[model samples]
Target: MADEYRPEFIRRKFTITESLDEVLKQMADRYYQGNVSLCLRASIESYREILEGEGYMATRRIERQLENLVDEQRTLLMEITSVRSGLQESHRESADGQQLTEPSMTNEMVRIIELLKTTGDGLEFGDLVEQLDLGMHKVQPALGRLVDRGVVTRTGEDGERFTLAGFSQHYLRSGP
Candidate 1:
């Protein structure tokens, strides 16, 4: 399958100075039976030694520069990983400490928490208001404040439902 497409052969033209043309003509007449392609190939082959020497030196210099750039990229990646590891460690430590330090809950928050604890799954916005016998204006702001404090999280597709922040991770995993 891979061998189906064969590349087209392309011949490149090289312009020679008058002096070089004279030399190529003399060489062709003496040996190559007036074939210009043969004379041109031979003429180009004669310069391989000097041309290859310069190309080799240039390639070596470029290889060294590429090696330096690769080394720099590796070092940068290591530094980024180290910084990320440190940040994760600090976050874990802080999260653990937060459990020990509980913030004071408001009256509405206390009621919401109690209701959330009673329900095994979670509660939607309308359900919360209906159960608590509160207006939408009062319930919305209270829930918003609780969410800001991280006491509760808004879940579900439209984020119309609420649940205890810690407990939500378990029950709300399959939903929003």
Candidate 2:
């Protein structure tokens, strides 16, 4: 008998930035349990559908990305503003003593929280800046506050990925 059913794979040497390489290794360890090949394959498959989908062109992809960025920003700003204002007056004045003990979510925290909600997996510091139209100056403190409060989590060689509270163990190498 001959062994007939086997899945062959493509092997190629790809050069990625050192930071990216580090993140990939981390994701493999955390998500794929040190299976780098499977981690890479899963990532490629997830992105492949978008880049290779029917009726999708390069121009369309760019436009969609831009449009998505705008929409995401708009929605984030709106939610952050509303929540910050709405929460400010209510946080300390809650009928129960529980919420009063907790600090209110600020505009920055609200923005980060809302953005994390919409992500497929998680995001890095760079991703947060790019997506939130917020500078490192703005994001650092807010992210720190959230992480400090246990409402979010950060992991990697340099805290490369951030996700909501319950998703701390989830990883996917963060950026494109």
Candidate 3:
């Protein structure tokens, strides 16, 4: 009964790279307050959890896949929350009593908006091509998309100029 509270430890040692040793030391310092032994034990429990159920490589692979799926679930939840908040913000009104909107834009559209900002009235199609360094095949489709979305305008004798319009702010936002 006297020895019941006393714990016995099985010790093992393996060589690791200097960088790994440094990382372990840093983790111990921050999380365990320099309790390296406790840190090691906590880490080894990850392997123990996998092996205890059914000690096989297939079991380990399945557990790792489940862990990855959990991580992806967390990521998707964060994205959904972000989209909900953006929707709420879009419905808000400004101090001037004008409704503010959040426009969905791609990376290329954001770049187009930024380039147009550098010009005074607007940028001609040729200017966008020169500044953006993209082929006509790419730029034309994106311009057409923006014009359809009403976030951009085409006003000229033959519709040669493409200007960022309607949207209050650049925002420069994109996501899944």
Q: lDDT tens string, model 3, 1-176?
A: 47677678988888989998898999999999999889888888867866676446767788999999999999999999999998678645444323323456566676776677555557888889889998877888877777786767876788788765653333322211
Colliding pairs, model 2 = none
lDDT for 140 in candidate 1 is: 80
Count clashes in each candidate, considering only residues at least 3 apart in sequence or on different chains: 0, 0, 0
lDDT, candidate 1, 1-176, per-residue tens: 56787657469977879998888788898889987678877767666744878657777889999999999999999999999997555434233223212345556666776677666567998899999888888888888888887767877888878877775334333433
What TM-score fits each model?
0.37, 0.36, 0.37
Which window of ten consecutive residues has the lowest lDDT sum in model 1? Answer: 93-102
Evaluated against the true structure, the overall lDDT of model 2 is 0.76
Candidate number with greatest lDDT: 2
Cα-based lDDT at residue 114, candidate 3: 67
Q: Look at candidate 1 and tell me the lDDT of residue 119.
A: 68
Query: Candidate 2 lDDT, tens digit per residue, 39-153?
Result: 9998988688667773357668889999999999999999999999976765443232223224466787888877886675679988998899988999999899888877678
lDDT accuracy of residue 142 in candidate 1: 80
State the displacement of the C-alpha of residue 41, model 3, in Å, after optimal TM-score superposition: 91
